[model samples]
Target: MTQKDAPTGADATIPGKLPATGHQGRQEPAAMTSTPTTTRTSTRAPLAAHGTGRVPPRSGAVLAGLCAAVLALSGCGGQKGGSPAAGSVPDGWGTLATSGVSVSYPKAGSGSGGYTVQTAGERSKYNAAAAERTEHGVTVSLITIQLGFTRADTAEDAAIAAEAGIQLGSTIRSTRKVKLAGTGDARRIDFEFGSTGEDRTPPKGTRIEGVILTGLDSKDRTFAVRVDARKGTLPDADLKRIVDSIEVH
Candidate 1:
């Protein structure tokens, strides 16, 4: 075959020869000739190629979730704090008049004469009440209200009771219980002793008149009002009226 009719990459010419241009004859070139050539190479790639270091998309979402959880936990452990103001007493409670002094009681009752309650100290301060009445000639009107709670509401209830006691008198007494009546408001009551004559000391045969009246309000707050006076000085009928008048709304 001649070189002009040969296919690419196929060995077509003999060394140092060319076909001659003559009838039924060919002449070869003086020097051998060669054609231009090309070469190719290929590289394969992997399915998952890595880039410069970076956080995954889900990492940001996880971090946000963790931050939210920490905030919620901190909020749950917080506490409440404050102080009570005068005359800002809790609802369903009121003060009774007794001469120059006053006492705390339910608003329902009415009393005549000097059988009154005083919230001021020195006017009527509360001293300790022991197993029995002594030279003080005093008696305590005690009342206790029990409540049921699913958790520790004890501190809050105690604070409320203490505030009420302070407003009632300097010699006021108070306590708390976890179990209570249908309303679930726990409570306790104490008394104020009166001094006889001008000496401000316990008087001989000065019997103490004691009574406690209680009722519950819609807000689950218990109302316990107490009255302590001189037996003869405060009429039995009037004292009964005061006790019976306590009405809880």
Candidate 2:
């Protein structure tokens, strides 16, 4: 038998099968090969190392905390209202010894409780020293001491003579006698005076209030201590304390 060519087109059939036009005997489509797919996932690190994921504090807040810590460590923020301890001497006090006198003085500087001592000179017959305390360019308190040897009958007599000479252009406010420790009878005089220039007329707004104390030691030495304040600046108690602390050797 001659092999017949497979039928052409949709009518072709296998040799052993009967010829059929319906699509029942066609070879099934080749099995499809599936490609495997892989999924990739990514992870990110936390914002902070502490792992709590919180942002850092602001710079200003950090600086303020540091300052507060420093202040606390320095111990400088406790007292609100307080006073100096009783029976305690003021700070910055020092001793001044010159020309046979030794005394306690506040700090040393111009307008800050300093003093200058001068011994007897050709123009003056006494040893003198002056201490001054000032505020805002104005003298608030001044202490002046003069020491000399005199041949007067008594300390009071010598002080009166000295006062007469010193009060030439000054107004005497009052005079009295006061007793001092380790000294004989003493004379105290209060005065008010105005500053003068070559014209010999008192200057305006330059009135000074002064107190003078003169007495003699056991060896008949005449000593005088004067204190001057700008019209009401000196406290009586403080002045008394300063004068009482004077020591003349």
Off by over 4 Å in 1: 1-112, 115-201
Q: Using alpha carbons, what is the TM-score of model 1?
A: 0.27
Candidate 2 at residue 238, lDDT?
51
Candidate 2 global CA lDDT score: 0.36
Task: For candidate 2, write residues 7-79 as lDDT tens digits.
Answer: 2111211110101100000011123211122111112111110011112222444445432321100101111
lDDT of each: 0.23, 0.36
Per-candidate clashes come to: 21, 0
- After aligning candidate 2 to the native by TM-score, how far in Å is the CA of 177 from where it should be? 1.6
Q: Which candidate should be chosen as best, given lDDT against the real structure?
A: 2
Cα-based lDDT at residue 100, candidate 1? 16
Reference-based TM-score, model 2: 0.49
Please give, for residues 147-183, the per-residue lDDT of candidate 1 as tens digits. 1111123323322322222211122222222111122
